[model samples]
Target: MELDPKALALFKEGYDKIIEGIKTLGFDVTDENFADTAARAAKGLHELIHDQTQVRKDVDALLAKTFPAKYTEMVISKHNTCFGVCPHHLLPVIYRISMAYIPTEKVLGLSKLSRLARLIARGPRLQEDLTHELADLLHVNLASQGSAVYIEGLHMCMAARGVGAHEARLVTSGVRGVFLELATREEFIKLVVAPPTTLV
Candidate 1:
């Protein structure tokens, strides 16, 4: 997808300002090795926070590819690894997401579940918000009987700074419809925390 040239230019300007800020701390931004640093940083940051409108478009396209379900059963996709930037500290967050839904008539392609998680996580967002958004999308877009999203996030803001609690992980969940039931919620949580099956 083509990025907006104007936005790219603005991002470069922002990065340039950051480099100047670093200079105040006695970091030499003018060294030969740092010539293209601002440009590269700008480009990388832009990609990390890809255009949200385009992301939503991609998500809609994926959801459009659903197939009719022969039976109504719980569908679960686990360990969908995703990356995002923390809005507060601008640090990276690593996410392991698990999703479950009981289909009403149609169901998403299995791989689409993982793709959906990654797409939604491509920008700066809070873990709590991401969890709720994922559940809302599955429940509403697929017209599912119920949907649930569970996420475990390792935030760099927590690990690399503050109290430096490197082992800290944040867990969050969102549920809708029948997933709001106590038994159904417990089942989802149990499966999420269960050990992976041995590969044959």
Candidate 2:
């Protein structure tokens, strides 16, 4: 969507004030290119906080293909990495997501699974919310007997502020349908915790 001219002017004003604020703090920003640089910075910030169209389009495309399930076995996609912006601080959070589903009637394209995960991770979101949203998406879209999502993230908000525990990692999960069963849940967890393969 095109931004309103009035709104753009207001945003430019805000950026100008930010430049002035830095000047008051003893940083010189009188260079000729400074205004252009500040404008770009402001535009980038606006996009990061407000833009969702591209990611939405990506998700729609990802869900475009489906086929009938031919087997009763589980399908797992593991250790997919993506990034999200934290709602509270607007800082970036790096995510490693693992997902699984047992197909009932329909199945989704395998590559699109990761694409969906990445799309959901694009905007300002909580890790817990991200996990459940992915699981729910699969449960509904695939008409699966079960679905699960596990997420591990390194949040810049926590590490860059507050008590600043640099080594901290956050983990969250969501499970639905048959995945709620103890045996099935345990099986998924075991696969997630297994050692990674190494190439010779």
Candidate 3:
């Protein structure tokens, strides 16, 4: 498989550490038994750090390339689904993200909004952090008058194993700019929480 040189190097270093640890624990770890270990370790490390670094640059580039227009209306994208493991439990949290931003002089491409959601959802994450991070990206990227993001998720930490509050879905939100400045926050919240058909 193709590999990042840096990641490959780190994978080798990590592989030695893992082998040492397993041997120290008195396990009969060997090259054959541990061959896939380095690959998986590298993969986990890559996914965790990719967004923490290069992905942020991608977001920054998109923001810089955006051209502004006079569309100062609440831009809402809803029901975008997300699936991932929780940082705490490594259990899954499946959810939908809803985003809205009133453009000031700039508007991001519609699909980038979803791309942002995907980036923020990478690796294990807390649903709360996931919600706020997406909103923060939108708020910062658009430099908008208002931005709001809300997430509704069913966490495996709660369902699929635990007390089985199968009906229990968590709600998390982040509001910024005019979303936090004016009555827009309430309006956006109401609209997002309101009936679907009410929006044209």
Candidate 2 accuracy as TM-score = 0.80
Query: Predicted candidate 2: what Cα RMSD to the true structure?
Result: 3.4
lDDT of 3 by residue, 1-200 (tens): 13367766776687778778988998877757776776776675555434456667766776676667666889988877767678777666777888998887888888878777766776677888888878777777667776899888888788876675977989999988888865887877777776456346
Query: What lDDT score goes with residue 185 in model 2?
Result: 93
TM-score against truth, every candidate? 0.92, 0.80, 0.70
Model 1 lDDT vs. the true structure? 0.90
Question: Which pairs clash in the backbone of model 2?
Answer: none
Task: Give each model's clash number.
Answer: 0, 0, 0
State each model's C-alpha RMSD to the native: 1.7, 3.4, 5.4
Q: 101, model 1: CA deviation in Å? A: 0.6
Candidate 3 lDDT score at position 45? 57
lDDT of 1 by residue, 7-75 (tens): 788989988898889999998777888898878887777766778888989999999998999989899
lDDT of 2 by residue, 1-200 (tens): 34445545666788888899988999778877685866676565554444467566666767668888888788999889888789888778888899999998878888889878877887688899999989988898677898999888999988787585877889898999999999999999889867567758
Evaluated with lDDT, which candidate comes out highest?
1
